[model samples]
Target: MRKAWALLALLGWLCGLAPAIAQVSLPADLTQRELVIGTRVAPPFSMKNAEGAWEGISIDLWRHLAERLGVRYRFEERDTVQALLDAVTTGQVDAAAAALTVTAARRQVMDFTQPFFATGLGVAVGRGGATAWLPVLRTFLSFGFLQGVLTLLGIALLVGTLIWLFERKHHEAYGGPPLRGFIAGAWWSAVAMTQAGAAQDGPRTLPGRILAVIWMVASVVTIAVFIAGITSALTTQRLQGVVRNVGDLRSIRVGAVSGSSTVDFLNAQTVGFESYGLPAQGLRALKAGRIDAFVYDRPLLAWTIQQDFPELEVLPITLDSQNYAIALPQDHPMRVALDVTLLDTLRSEWWTRTRLRYLGNDAAN
Candidate 1:
C-alpha cells in the first residue's frame, strides 16, 4: 500500500511539471494576429502618399518589425498625436509610430520602446515676405535712427548760424538783411552737408573760409557715420523678425502641429500660436501669412521644407531636444519584444539607410 501511494504521488508531480515545461517551451502565437497601429501625418516619419497609401520611415520600421515577429498590422490614421496616445492607452491600438517624442509625462501614461531617432524643435518661416528692404524701412522708423537724425540736424543748424555770423559783414552771399543772410547761410550749409555744391559763393573772410572747411569735413564724417548706422539698423531689424530661439517666438504668429510636444512647449512659454492637424497644414498657414513661424520636429520639418516648401527656411536654433520612439500601452506584453527589435534596428546599418532614404542627405544629426 505504501508503494502504490508513492507511485500516485510521483505521477501527480510529473503532471504538474508537464504543464510548466509546456508553458516555458511554447510561446504565445503572435503570428497572423492583427495588430492595429495608430499614426498621423508627420513627414519623414509617417504620412500618406499620393495614392493614399501609408509610407514613411516609421511605417517602414513598423512593417519591418511586424515582418520580423511574423505578425500582421494595419495602420489606423489618427488626427493627432494625443489621439494616438489615447488609442494605445485604451487598447484601441496595439502600438503607435510617428515622429513621437518621448517625454516624462508621456512615459507616465504609455510605454515607449527604446529610442530609434533623436531630434529637436525647429522654426520655419515663409521666404516671400522676408525681403531685405522691409528691414531697412523698419530701421528708418526706429527711435535710434530718429535720434541720430535729430542730432545731425542740430549740428547742421549750429554750423549754419556760425557761417551766417562770420560771412554777414563781408561776403555778398550773406550781405543782405540779418534774416535773409541767415536763411541763405542755412541753405548753403544744408547743400554743403549733403555733398552737393552750394548754390552761391561761400564766405569770403579768412575766419569764414576756415569755418566752412571744418563744416565740410564734419559733414563728410557725419554722413559716413549715418550710413553705417542705417546699415547696422537694417541688420538688427532683419534679425529681430527672425525666430532664432524659443524666446523670440512670443512676438510672432507661431503655428504648431496639434497635439504635439511643440505645442506644449509653446503653451508653457505663454506664446500665442495656431495649431494644425498636420505639418503640411502648418506650412500652408506659414506661406499664406496666417502664421509668421511654424514650429515642429527638426528632422521631419527640415525634410518637408526641403521637399515641398522650398520657399521656407528652418531656423538654426533647436529647442526641447528629445528622442523619438514607438509608443505602446503601459505594461504591454510586447514591450520587451518591440524594444529588442528597435534597439537592434537602430544599431544596424538598416537605420542609417532608412533614415537617409526618407530624410535625405541633409538630415539633422
Candidate 2:
C-alpha cells in the first residue's frame, strides 16, 4: 500500500511539470521555416541605411535571436507602427521589431518580449525661432523678482528716513521741508548703495555719519544679492523655453507624433496638440515656428537631433516612463525562448558596448 501511494505522488509531480517543459521546448519545424518579421523605421532601433539595408538596435537583437535559434526569417517593412502591430495581431508576421513601447492597451491585443531598454518621453525645441518676449515679461512680473525689488526699495526708504532724523537739524544736504528732505536723503541712500559718488555732501553729525557707514557696508551685501537675483531670474527664463513640463503644454502650441502613445497621454491630460505623421515632421514644424514644442521618445529624439538637427535640442525633462520591447503575436510559441535569450544578451558585455555606441556615456543612466 505504501509503494502504490508513492508511485501516485511521482506521477502527479510529472503532471505539474509538463507545462514548464513544453514552454522551453522549440517546435520541430521552427528551424526549417522562413519567419515573417515586421518592422518600422524608428531610428536607433530600426532604420534603413544609405544602401537601403535595415540596421539598428532592435534589428540587431532580432538578428541575434534568429541566428541563435537557427531559424530563417525575412523582414517586412511597414510605414506605421500601428500597421506593424496590426500585422502581428492578425498573424501576418511572426513578430514586430522596432522601438515598440509596452502599454496596457497594447498588451490586450499582442504579447511582448522582456523589455530590453527603458526610458521616458522627452521634449524638443528649435533654436532658430525668435525668442518669445512673454517669458521675459513674465519673469519681471514674477513674484520672486518683484519681491526682491520691493525689498530693496523698502530698505532704502527705511535707511533714508533714519538719515533724515539724524541730519535734519544741521546738514544742509538734508535740511528742508519734510518731503524735500526725505527725497534728498533717499537719493543719497540710492547713490550710496551703488557706491556711485553722491551729488550732495556727506552728513556732518556723529550719529548721522555712523549710520551712513553702517548702511554703506550693509548696502554692499544687499545690492550684491539683489543683482544676483535678477541675473538668476533672467538666465533661467532664457534657458527654460515656453514649455517646461506637461502642464506648460496647455498654454503653448504643442506637436507630437500621430497615433503614438504620447498623443494618448496628451489627450488624457486634455492638452491640445497638433499631430504629425512622424517626429521628423514635427521637428521641422518646430523649426518653422508652426509649433512651440515637440514631444516624443527620448532616445530617438536625442539620436535624430544629434545626427541631423543641430539647430534643435531635446529638453532635460521627461514626461512619462516607457519600456521598449519586441512585440509578438498573443501567446507566441517562441516567447519563452526569446525571453531567455534576450535576458542573456542584455546581460552581456557586448550589449553594454552596443548601447554605449548608440546612446553615449549616459546610456547606463
Candidate 3:
C-alpha cells in the first residue's frame, strides 16, 4: 500500500493558527505516516454523536479511501466551522470531511475530495406565523404585504404632518421618547401597510395625549396582525405550502454539510456562503460570526435549531427542491476511488449498515 502523508499545519507561522500542508510519500513509518483530517458533525453524512463515535456515509467513505490508499487517518472531532475550514487552509489536517461540496469560491481557497453524497436546499419559517392580526389574518384570507406597506406610508404622512405642526416638527424617526417614537413609527408602519383607508386621518390638529392613545390602540392591532401572518404561513403551508425562491437568501450566509447538494446548489447559484464539514461546525459558525444564514434541507433542519440550536429561526422561504449527493474536491485522487467504491458499496451489505448509521438524522427537523 502506498503511504499518503497527511500533513498538519505549515512548518512555521506566527499566528499559532494551523498551517497549510504539503503532501509527501511514506517511508515505512505507518504509525508516523497517519493523516489527521479536520472535520465537523454534519448529520446523515458525517458527524460525531454524543456517544463519542464517528459514523455516517462520509466517514465510511474516508475509511475506504484510507484503506485502499493504504494510509492511516485519525479523524479529528473539530468544534467550529471556521476552524475546520481554517485547518484546510493552514494545512492543520490532510483534508476535511462532513459532506463538503466542491465549489468555485471554495476551490479558490481549498482543494476538495470527490463527491460522496448529494443533498439540496430546504426552507423553514418561524415557530409558525401568528394567526391573530388582520394583516396577518388577511394573508390567509387572500392578503398581500403590499397593502400593509401602503398603509404605513399614509400613516407616516399623517403623523409627520401633525408632528410638524404640533409636536417635534424637527424630530427624526427615533428622536423623541425613544420608546414612544419607535412604537409610534413601527406600529404606524405595520398598520398602514396592513389596512386600507388609513389616509383619512391626515393630522387634523390632534393633542399629544390623543395621539398617544391612538398609537397604543394601533400597536395592539399590529401585534395581532403579526401573529396572524405567521400562523397563516405555517399552517396554510403545511396543508398546502407556499412557494419562495433562493434569491431571498442573497444576503444570508447559508450552511451546508460541507459537500452535500445544498452546498453545491448554493455554490452553483453564487449566493453568499459559509461551508461546514459538519452541521455542528456550520451551526457553530452561525454563532461564532462566520456566516449569518445556514441553509439545509427543510425537513432536516426544521426543528434542528429549535431542538439542538434553539437560538436560530427558520426564515420565510425555501430556495429549491433538489437531490442530495456526496461531493469530494474536484479531481481529488479519492474521486475515482470513492466513485467506484460507492458503486460497489451500494451493493454490499455494509452499505445498509453505513446508511442506517446517519441516514435519517436531519438536523433541521
lDDT score, candidate 1? 0.81
User: lDDT tens digits, residues 1-365, model 1?
Assistant: 99999999999999999755433211365454777889988787888888999998899999888776667778999987888889988989889998889987888889999988887888887774753244456567768889999998888888888888988888877877888888888888888899876446787889878988998998999999899878776776666546656766776678998878887788888889988988899999888888888999888888899889998888677888879999988887787777766666777787788888877775446
Better of 1 and 2 by lDDT: 2
User: Candidate 3: worst 10 consecutive residues by lDDT?
Assistant: 17-26
lDDT comparison, 1 vs 3, better candidate: 1
TM-score of candidate 3 relative to the true fold: 0.46
lDDT of 2 by residue, 1-365 (tens): 99999999999999999756534556867667899999999989899999999998889889987777778999999887778878989999999899888998899999999999998998888763663554677788889888888889999888888888888999887887999889888888888888888536667889889989999999999999888878887777767765667887887888999877888788989999998988889989988889888999988999888888898988778888899999999998888888987887898887888777766786774
lDDT of 3 by residue, 1-365 (tens): 12322233232342343321222233455435777766676555565668978866667767765665567778886665556666776767766766454556666776654344544456432333331122234355544555664565566556544443444444354346645655554554344434544632223335743774675477567657766776666566454322246654564445566555576677678876766665556766665545655777654564366657765556556565543334333344444444555565556666566665554453221
lDDT (C-alpha, whole model) for all candidates: 0.81, 0.85, 0.55
Q: Which 10-residue window in model 2 sums to the lowest lDDT?
A: 126-135
Candidate 1 vs 2: which has more TM-score: 2
TM-score of every model? 0.72, 0.84, 0.46
Ranking by lDDT: 2, 1, 3
Q: Evaluated with TM-score, which candidate comes out highest?
A: 2
